[model samples]
Target: MAEYAEITYTVEDRIATITLNRPQARNGYTVRMSDELADAFGRADSDEEVRVVVFTGAGDHFCVGADLSQGGFDFDGEPDGPWQEPAGRCAKRIFLMNKPVIAALRGAAVGAGITITLSADYRLAATDARFGFVFTRRGIFPEGASAWFLPRLVGMGTALDWMISGRLFGAEEARAAGLVQRVYEPDELLGKAYELAREIAASTAPVSVAVTRQLLYRMSGLDSPLPVHELDSKLIAGLPAHADSVEGVVSFFEKRPPKFTLEVGKALPAYLPWLDS
Candidate 1:
């Protein structure tokens, strides 16, 4: 329940919804907003009650990219570090989060706006949502690690086409290009997002979900299946002793929903594959 100037954070039914609140500016990206977003993701990751996160904008537009109201000098600022950009900060936080994240995108999602959501596990867009990687159009390069994430999500060919062209594309095109998983009417977007979140929260084990998320994202960068074999062998060996694994099996046999007591905050395995040196 933290108060944020550019966003709203609320948790309900084990789902945390982080909303971009600057609707008048089309939820324009700004330094402060990025910082708040990173903080919100951290909050969601640590809170045991939060099983999933749904990201969306307050009014109509999801985001129209950076706040260019200050003109060309908007990009001029002291470095947080050598290469750390505001959008990257938020996107990295989302990438590292243990809980699942679903972006319910509507209206304009351009430049950093669309790039940031590339790290999300799923993107459910409204039929009217328009996405553009407008960095080249604005005379700058892409940020938010889109170069790394975009190609991985949509393949190098599609990513190159979109980033290089900087043209606006609708939700259907986005889905076809692998950027979006599903599209809904504007009014139904949030409902569909929440439904997905609820389904995950109701059926899955928190620790298992967290570990699986990391394994899928992190293992993709590996050079071979040998590493995956080693990791899964380690994971499966230890999982059978955990309460969640027991409950998962018993609930399946009993034909009832699982009541997973293990929390991501406390129940995560100590030796994660990514944590290994």
Candidate 2:
């Protein structure tokens, strides 16, 4: 329930929704908004009651890119020091979160707008949504670690084409390129996102979801299967003793939905993120 200047954070059922709130500005990205977003994600990660997160924007636009009202040199004003870029901070937080995140995208999502959602688990876009990589046209490169995430989400060829051209494209192209999972009518986007979120919250084990999210994202970068095999061995060997595993088995035999009690904040496995030998 923390207050934010450029965003709204609220929780209902087991889903935490983070809404970009500057409708007049077209939900433009700003340094303050990045910090607030990171904080909100941290809050959701630590709250045992929160099982999923939904991200969206207010008004007609998801985001139109950086707020340039401060002038053309706004980005250059960052104090000279080794520091994480504003957009990267928020994106990194989303990447590391234990809870699943779904983005309900509509209207325009350009530059930082689209890049920020690259780390989300799923993106449900409105059929009318427009997307642009726009950074090349602005005389800057992609930020928000899109250089790394974009290639992984969409193939390197598509990533390079979109980013190099920096042209606007429609949601259908986005879905074909694998940037979005599904497309819905403008008014139905959020409702569909929430419905998916509720299903995950109600049916999945929190600890298993947390571990699976990290495993998939983190392991995708590995060059060999040995690392994955090692991690899988450890997880399979240890998971049999967990309460969630017992309940899952019992429920399958009893033909009933499982009520998982293992909490992500308190019950996550200690050997997660598998260290190399």
Model 2 clash pairs are none
Model 1: which ten-residue window has the lowest total lDDT? 72-81
lDDT of 1 by residue, 69-144 (tens): 8874254376666846878988999999889999999999998889889899999999999999987887889999
Ten residues in sequence with the least summed lDDT for candidate 2: 71-80
Candidate 2 lDDT, tens digit per residue, 1-277?
A: 3579999999999899999999999999998898899999999998999999999999999999888887852443556787677788889999988899999999999998998888999999999899999988999878999999999988999998999999999999999999999999999999999999999998899999998998998896899999899988988898678999999999999999999999887887777764331
| Model 1 CA lDDT for position 63 | 94
TM for candidate 2 is 0.95
The true-versus-predicted C-alpha distance at residue 5 of model 1, in Å, is: 0.5
Off by over 4 Å in 1: 73-80
